[model samples]
Target chain A: MIPAPVIAAFHPPRRTLLGPGPSDVSPQVLAAQSKPIIGHLDPLFVGMMDEVKALLQYAFQTRNEMTLAISAPGSAGMEACFVNLVEPGEKVIVCRNGVFGDRMRQNVERCGGIAVTVDHAWGEPVDPAAVAAALAAHPDARFLAFVHAETSTGALSDAKALCALAKQHQCLSIVDAVTSLGGVELRVDEWGIDAIYSGSQKCLSCVPGLAPVSFSAAAVAKIKQRKTPVQSWFLDQSLVMSYWSGGAKRAYHHTAPVNALYALHEALRMLANEGLEQAWARHKAMHLLLRNGLDALGVQFVVAEPYRLPQLNTVYIPPGIDDVAVRSRLLQQYNLEIGAGLGDFAGKAWRIGLMGYGARQENIALCLHALQQELSVVI
Target chain B: MIPAPVIAAFHPPRRTLLGPGPSDVSPQVLAAQSKPIIGHLDPLFVGMMDEVKALLQYAFQTRNEMTLAISAPGSAGMEACFVNLVEPGEKVIVCRNGVFGDRMRQNVERCGGIAVTVDHAWGEPVDPAAVAAALAAHPDARFLAFVHAETSTGALSDAKALCALAKQHQCLSIVDAVTSLGGVELRVDEWGIDAIYSGSQKCLSCVPGLAPVSFSAAAVAKIKQRKTPVQSWFLDQSLVMSYWSGGAKRAYHHTAPVNALYALHEALRMLANEGLEQAWARHKAMHLLLRNGLDALGVQFVVAEPYRLPQLNTVYIPPGIDDVAVRSRLLQQYNLEIGAGLGDFAGKAWRIGLMGYGARQENIALCLHALQQELSVVI
Candidate 1:
């Protein structure tokens, strides 16, 4: 609405996205991003939604009947899962190692649920034995929540074992695969994950708008039996299903991000063509290439090798090297985007991502070369 | 991740968006919708954000500063305003005549604020006398909230009067201009509206992902003085302001819907070129044409003419007519989109909208002709 006379320059940098997310978007995906906006209930857009659901099912290795993208980001996805499953006064065992886990605790407490948190060091995997001990101690806990890949520290948790432990304790399993889906192995159904959420910006290489989520039959059944209604109308899946499900008469929910779904559909199609397992291998291979370059430059990873996420590699900034200065130079000079460490690790480490379409050898080399130049100037 | 073999069709209907919103998008806007994705904080993208803020200020008719779009839809905008302004135990005087006003009451209670509601009849304009009485009754009320153009009932309330009442009573005002703004006359500065929220899909004719919002200086001051943190980290405007304000070192917020902003910019540009007064005239002109057609066809309006919205027209479904049957036929046969009545008025009315780019003489004729044909079959 500003006068056209005052319209400023909208020159976006053509940077190589090598951060936790969003990964570099493919041209095809980017083209899809700008598809004409359509009504959410338009037959064609609904078809696209149906396709996205199927693609997400394949990506998560799940046959769960309920699957769709929430219209907001990954945090909304986290909120959706908890608000639907955790009723007031319920006990939820939250596994905390990084920022996202702490977010889970916040969500639980906000919903009036008691969070029985099992803490682990940041940059370390969730301790399955400790989870088992907690489950043993608190048999009444209704759900076990954990992040599959903690973007904050680049650590991958034992999602399968954690789900198993939740099942043993008769608790539902909620997993945050925001930075893991398609980049790593995520067998939602096979691993017995009851409810899961993922971000489009990460391994999907789509713009960050929609959050793909799935609820297992058991999870749905639990929701159906809930004594209290979902507190947040925006995040309520019960009302959401009437709109997202396969039905003759779809109900009105909040409007969906129509064009963003087109981009997501394209990205998921690209992932489907490459195959999930092959994509995971590609991410792992590129991570190794980036790690080798960083190691050769005398950089140390914040997360230990065994549990490091291929998509996000967290590296410690050497003593006396300015974290902000190195990142600024990377952006200003090389047009390379990388993430700063979050929360406790802020100013101490850098997060370099090799994810989805960005997991190519060329991008890895470019990122490393840029980082080396920037680090040398700063150090 | 669906099998690459299952390719879905991307069919988009050319809807003459005559309902509540998701108005007809222009070819230029549609083309902008398809722009390539970029990092949210990319210099160019940040520049766009600044332009968008300026444009939003123009559309809202306000220059009080702190205007930006929340990444989610208009409902989220409502959430952002209430969550930031109304902390636990504060009192808010909400005037409820239709769905959005009821939603405001719900949000106030959910945010732990005491909601003092002034109820008006469905399909009727919010009564200023009732609002003034409520304000007088609840002298300690922190804010007054109401919908400017009620999408449910197609009633345009006296926003200027409401805001004046709020100011006189020493309380701020929250306005839902979702179906107003580009479609009708709104002067945030003249009206003294404190916090206003609108939808991208409505009069703006942009895709539905972002919610345009603006905070007055008084509202921002109230936010800063709040004792508790905004419950929603993603919607906390204090953090969001850093990313939206075109400062030298913009802080990193969540990744915005990058490509959607392109479409919005283009839409706003189109609006600017047309001029606000001209656009309002066009909407009124088209509405008059459509109203003539409806009156000729013996269709009575749900909302009385004097208080009715020029953009959205709510009409009673003739007795013995099936509302769903008529709408379904219109969708299948003419590919036209119109909205059904919401909340208490459901099954009684149909909402026909004439908004933004959708408010064309040709589109109005097409919608009227389509409705007449559908009605003959049902009636």
Candidate 2:
């Protein structure tokens, strides 16, 4: 028998979360999560789930009936859209600009779909002209996949323009709104996005477990008419729909993440209370405040202003500054956490997130002050 | 823009969860989950994650380094083990006795593996003789997959015996301990189990979402040397391990469910404090009390005494009783939730779970009293 190790109660240190994702969550959402654990199929919980769906629809700006949270993270949501919609040997045009875009290409290849690439530089938006060119060149492409907001580089592509191009080429569009959903303007119906997925942790400020996903009627129809079964049974929308869509007697797909849904519901309710336009404005305003402060500290943003994401602000580390040491000091000394850059910007940049609950003026002020103090010692 | 529906704050009803899974969570665990949100990669959170890993090691009775919680639920955990280990066209001997066993077969097939079947009656334990026969017949079978505790049937197969047989046949054992991990006697190292996955909600009494999975050295080796990449990118262990294992600077695979991990750590820590054997004895003793009370109510257990699981007690619906009406009354009036039968036993049996925090004498008394009151009017 393996002996139990003597471990103390884990009391996590409270830190202001200003990261690429998993931004600071509100006390209300945390309290909602801590409410009494109910059965997944309990009547009251189901009622709450319906409300969650409605709230998510409002957040995505879509009236589609297929909107519901995936049981995993945003990456799983990305995989779900591809595995369910892109069958084996189907050609999908994938736009590559940053880390998440590369992840989209990986998902396409793993699902046995050939990925036709349209490349753009990191810290830049997906060029609509390049996408149009790619779609025109590859007329056989059945789907176009791109990230609406690239978390790794804090770049926001023009999802509307990209979706229009997909439509022009007769290709269904799969959009990754993981970092863009509540923090930016995303109109699923208006943009004609066939499939879209977003994370609860980023802009929704819910805990980082659930992924809210929506499918257009076309996307749902494609799933229904797939010649082969969806490779991942856990993510198959066709089977999962029976559980999320139908009334009262929902089919058992997987045990719904009971408490996480509670948090999501509360987060989305909070988001609703603060109108989507208001939330977007708040994020943009906070980003500007942080930008002014950081500019005073000689910090330069990686992305151009027009394509930069308000929620995720990617800035280059100044010369002679050690990336790990500054982030470590900020976390340890100031009890503040900012995300390190990912992919191409790993050691070269830092991502300062002002997402949802973290978008307040105080958080941005605190983050800028902490960074200034930490970087002063190094730079 | 879609109009936001006005929704009230969700106040989940207080429930005595006595269901097949998602047993009553402790107030301590719930409180732990409400702690301040931290970044998934924050140093303190990473330190807590290490502690969680250590506590999980105590719970699984193994020192395997590959043990970590999947961000999704148990079904995804089941899929993770299958997709990572079983390659296309690979033959795996799948033991079927209940709903979860059938799910294992689904996972195998979804991963492009052929599932060789060994069947047992729904409420019966997996037949070791049949398994041995199948292994002998299919010498090329690389994996033996079975559920140790079938949640749907309230049956506990002999995991030690099953794993030993798989060892003798040179097949790596994949055990589904979703309901068995903390409720029963499970020794991963001693039993020679290779890959094991479990749900946090069942015996662990944590909020539902995370699936704790562990891989033995052989299982890890097999995954590392796979001819093809795992089909599901989200469930891929090879990439996930880089994030979970090794030193301080861990790779970023996915943003983990921070609050849920807090709950799991507390739940596992509580289990460690209680001691595994003591926990097993507590579940067994509570089951006995529940059994006596249920017996007084004229309830007949479906599984034989030796094979019956202490945590999930499956009993036949007495003749002429309305399953829906009785369960509904119990839920509506008593604020109690019990699982209706699943798979073949739907509407024919009731699964009374006395799991983890729900396995107290008072809970047992309340469930029996509630059932008696509801049944009197219906029967």
Question: What's the DockQ for every one of the candidates?
Answer: 0.41, 0.88
Report per-candidate TM-score of chain A alone: 0.97, 0.99
lDDT, residue B148, model 2: 96
Q: What local lDDT score does residue B203 receive in model 2, on the 0 to 100 scale?
A: 94
Task: Name the top lDDT candidate.
Answer: 2
TM-scores of the candidates are 0.92, 0.99
Cα lDDT tens digits, model 1, B232-323, are 66678998888887486787666677777887888887787788888998888888999999998889999888998989999999887898
Per-residue alpha-carbon lDDT of candidate 2 for residues B124-185, written as tens digits (9 for 90 to 100): 99999999999999999999999999999999999999999999999999999999989999
Candidate 2: which pairs clash? Answer: none
State each model's CA lDDT, in order: 0.85, 0.92
Give residue A300's error in model 2 in angstroms.
Answer: 1.1
TM-score of 2: 0.99
Candidate 2 CAPRI grade: high
